[model samples]
Target chain A: MDSSPLVLTLASIILASTPLIIAVCGEILTERSGIVNLSLDGTMLMSAMTGFVVAFETDNVWLGFLGAMGVGAFFAFIVAFGSIRLRQSQFAIGFVLTLLGDDLSAFLGQNYTRIPGPVVQHYAIPILKDIPIIGPIFFNQNVIVYFAYILVFVTWFWLFRTQPGLRLRSAGDRPEAGFARGVGINFQRYLYTIIGGGLVGVAGASYSLNIKIGWAEGLTRGFGWIALAIVIFGGWSPIRGMFGALLFGATKALATYLQRTFPEVSVVAFNAIPWVLMILVLLLVGSDFTERVITVAPKSLRRPLQRFLKISPPQALGSTFVED
Target chain B: MNANRWIRWVWPAVPIAGALVVTSLLLFFFGAAPLEAFQAMYDGAFGDQAKTLSVLAFWVPLLLAGTGLLVTFKAGLWNIGIEGQIVMGAIAASWVALRMEAPSAVLITVEILAAMLAGALWAALSAVLKTRGNVHEIFSGLALNSIAIIFTNYLISGPWQPPEGGTFRGTAPFQPGALLPLYENSRFSPLSLLLAAIAFTLVVIALRGTFWGLKLKAIGQNLRSAFLLGVSSEREMILAMMLCGALAGLGGAVRTLSWFDSLRQSISGGIGFMALLVVMLANYRMFLVPPIALFFSAVLSGSITLQLRTQLHSSLGGILTELMVLFVLLFGDWKKLGVFRKKDDDG
Candidate 1:
């Protein structure tokens, strides 16, 4: 086998996995806080559509990025409202939001299909760009790629190495403990979920701004699901999640490579490889991963932190600390 | 006591009223007069015997799919892969329909059975993963949906491709003898409707009058408690999935034998998701599924007419259906409102 093609293939996989890396990392943070948001798929889809539309209209890729973040935040707010304020079932509300997001995207995006948008250009570092095999692959990428790496590090640092991160984790893991310490656990959850959602939105926008540069019906095509799966595979840690995403990206890239090489193998089966791989990874990892990581999940996230239900938020997460 | 009795009726009614209001508002936004659009929808769906039959044609598959979903819901499982199961079912039915040379009656029966079995088996994968492998049913169900679509695509594009190259996107048409005969020059097939009705009735009876239904409901409300009570929650979950898959598979078979004659790419056509909406709106009540399913089918059938008569895209039917579900879910909480609030120990 030619190393050149393999090298090129590896490079492509890295690029493909960047969005998943970012999105899953964000979701890990949100879930660590104790809420399960199944609406990420819809959030990504809507953001992808919005990013493309805004980019095309404004000719500024940054605007598309921001627009996608706004839309993503808005969707997260809806999930928050339903799960936290309304006391609805987290899974049900998340599912409904997913459906609603999908339809809303389709309704709004009907006209923008196939339209060209502003494509983010690569900014190669002179020294790094010249480094043989790794140079072009790693050093010669657009801002979004760099931003994805930055986000991974930022998230990793924020999660493990900072005070606020610890508090956020506490809020998610044991809201009662956090609340007993006088922390407003619900507010922390609300803050982090909205911010995490905004990041996921950016990840979604990156699909259009950096990857495909256009929109299509069902364009996300279960990428959100892949991201969700990756969050678990990564053990809900930013660094691990990034690795899982890269692994998936590699598999996806390999599938594409194999499809081109082995034209005889049905493309339909090839397309299914990622989903099959996700299921396999999920099964192999077992349910312990979900239990372990989720055990530390924020109390507010436990039961639709956004909805108004019979249960109160981790007894601490959502309280505003009203003084007598 | 009388007021308390009325509360039961009010729970279901409020959601319906809210849905209607929301639908009207959506129609108004679309620049169609709400009343006129409603009239058009009514006429399009049931203006004539032919139209009524067309509505029934759509209704049967949806009703069947919804009924299958209800079974899973009873067992505290959400089988979102109904779409995939339906697709697989169609594939199985089409495979048999296209190949077999048996008598129509025998072939149709075999095809239906084959489809149901295939669907049940596909659904069983999720159950096995959930019960034995500890994979969440939701994740398994979602993953199965993707796998199903891919499998369908492979079959259609490869083994099942019609001989014609340019236009045919599905399997070859079934033999005339293999097809289910419709009643007297009507587009509606009584066979499908009758099958759907019987299936619904059976499910209703099973849920209300059988020990199994009680076991299923018990598990759905609290799996741990059910397990403690020796209900075999895991087994019941698997059984529910199989039953759900079988009903959906039967619906797929009926569509192939009675309506299409050939298996198309979009044979299931989002019916699984639509059925989900129907089930949710009906609050997972078995008897409530039919009327809701019929109402949705009428909306869909009417949309085709609206497309022919107006400039609106047929996709409007899908939009309306999604909106209807959203409205139902949104206002489903009206019973908690102050006006309807029950007197309690605390405010």
Candidate 2:
């Protein structure tokens, strides 16, 4: 059963989604702090380039990850400083940085393109890897993938089950209230944004060193945008975001499966699936149609449905918090 | 008054200089000579008549996209789906060109109209999604943009494959009647430039001299208050988006008919996104659109040669432009500068 195509595909899907899972986690934290770092696409591209280059030059994968985290934090710091202190438009600056990061990565990675670099070593948990189908699908992966799994639960716990989490939520939802409670709103925004950006940086490094394994122009190009969409689909919760990432991975795997099964089908057609899914998933959460559906449902189903389908962005997601 | 005039000239220069320093430092870090790269880029963009004309040809579509964005920006809409509008326009024009056979003048006129209508409809989708479904235009626009590209790929590869076969390049070059007349064996079309200029002038007038422009300004400043003042925010927002889409569609038509003479993949080639950058760099000002768009066009065109001469990546132009916009956003407000604050305090 473990060697069957179904199990193999499921295993690969888990492996492929690690970066996206990591990226969504990062973005959730950032957006929760009332900052939208729309530069995820470019940041990932630049950091992917940086990660590969540093690893190649230093012959150390850990250093590459560190360098990437630093780069990510630096970019997020700029976003935080500009939006929080300088009071510029977050979207505009983020968009510009996306374009800049793309170009900068291409220009800087010119020499690094297609060169062999350090690859993340795989380490399956000894006992866990032996635990039937689930073991092979989840536990039998590289350290980065394992780290992503742990990060998801940690993120969920940090955001929902802690005292600091309440302050963070207040920082995004009601800055005035948070300020009244003596929270350093700006400082919280900066700290969380940088930390989230560093996680995104890890996602980028994961791509270059583990999943994709080389430097190239536009390496991991559209994934960042997809990750952004997934953050919305997940309704700003890390646990839900992980499922969104997995669903995206499953669709991609299905596309690959279809292409292999039906060679006559143009592969380009399948490229549209994730994007179309992005629209549909967003529609599901963004519209009040879900609420209407819940209204018509049985009482027992309605509560569970409401818990699952409810989606609302942070009140101060894109606005500058001017504290008195 | 003289100092104020001088300050206006000098202030904008700050961001440009900052961009230059940052780009130069990037080059220096990468072991490339900044001066040499800049020289190469300049030579590549304006080395001769052909290069200059190429820049102008590129400028026409970019200028149109930038001009259209002024309307949406005035109404406080992002309209990022402008890229899709351009793509839909190209597809519409392509459909007419591929299916309809008529005199050149009639065919061209119909194609342009079809392109504009298609673009308007596409933009309208995002607007409706926002007003009715409560989805943000940014997300809807992005989704629609992907759908447009997917539709293009499906059409070119599946239904509209060339007579010989499909290599995914594009439909066979359109009949002469379907294509815009070129000038001096170049892809440049004088008619498209004229159309773009007309669009620019009309938008400027619409934005500066009309009550509609005032309403849009009111909406942009505060939508709730604008609604309270009896303005129909929904209708105006939709109209602004459609207007921008129409202009962008014309840009796509220009691109397909003049730039490549076929409905090719990636036909918009980031022109719509570049237009977003151009408008942002212009600080959403109307009159500044043309010159800034032209500058961006020149830089991009020059980067092609800069790649060959300096062995640098062609995205060097994108980096330079993006940095300028970034710095401007960070420090563009002259009143926020410490020196100006002191001056205001003295006054």
Q: Please give the distance, in angstroms, between residue A112's alpha carbon in candidate 1 and its true position after superposition.
A: 1.8
Q: TM-scores across all candidates?
A: 0.87, 0.95
Quote the positional error of residue A217 for candidate 1 in Å.
Answer: 2.4
lDDT of each: 0.77, 0.88
Name the candidate that leads on DockQ: 2
lDDT of 1: 0.77
- lDDT (Cα, tens digit) per residue for candidate 1, span B189-306: 7877888888888989999899999999999899999999999987888898999998898888877777688888778877887898889878776778888899999988887777
Lowest summed lDDT window (length 10), candidate 2 chain A? A1-10
**Ten contiguous residues with the weakest lDDT in model 1 chain B:** B338-347
Error of 1 at A241 (Å): 2.0
lDDT of 2 at B30: 70
> Per-residue alpha-carbon lDDT of model 1 for A154-268, expressed as tens digits?
9889988998888888776787776788767667666777777787898888898888779876778578877877776676678878888998888877787789999988877
Q: Each candidate's interface RMSD, rounded to one decimal?
A: 3.2, 3.1
Off by over 4 Å in 1: A1-3, A287-324, B1-39, B165-168, B185-187, B308-310, B335-347
lDDT at position A25, candidate 2: 95
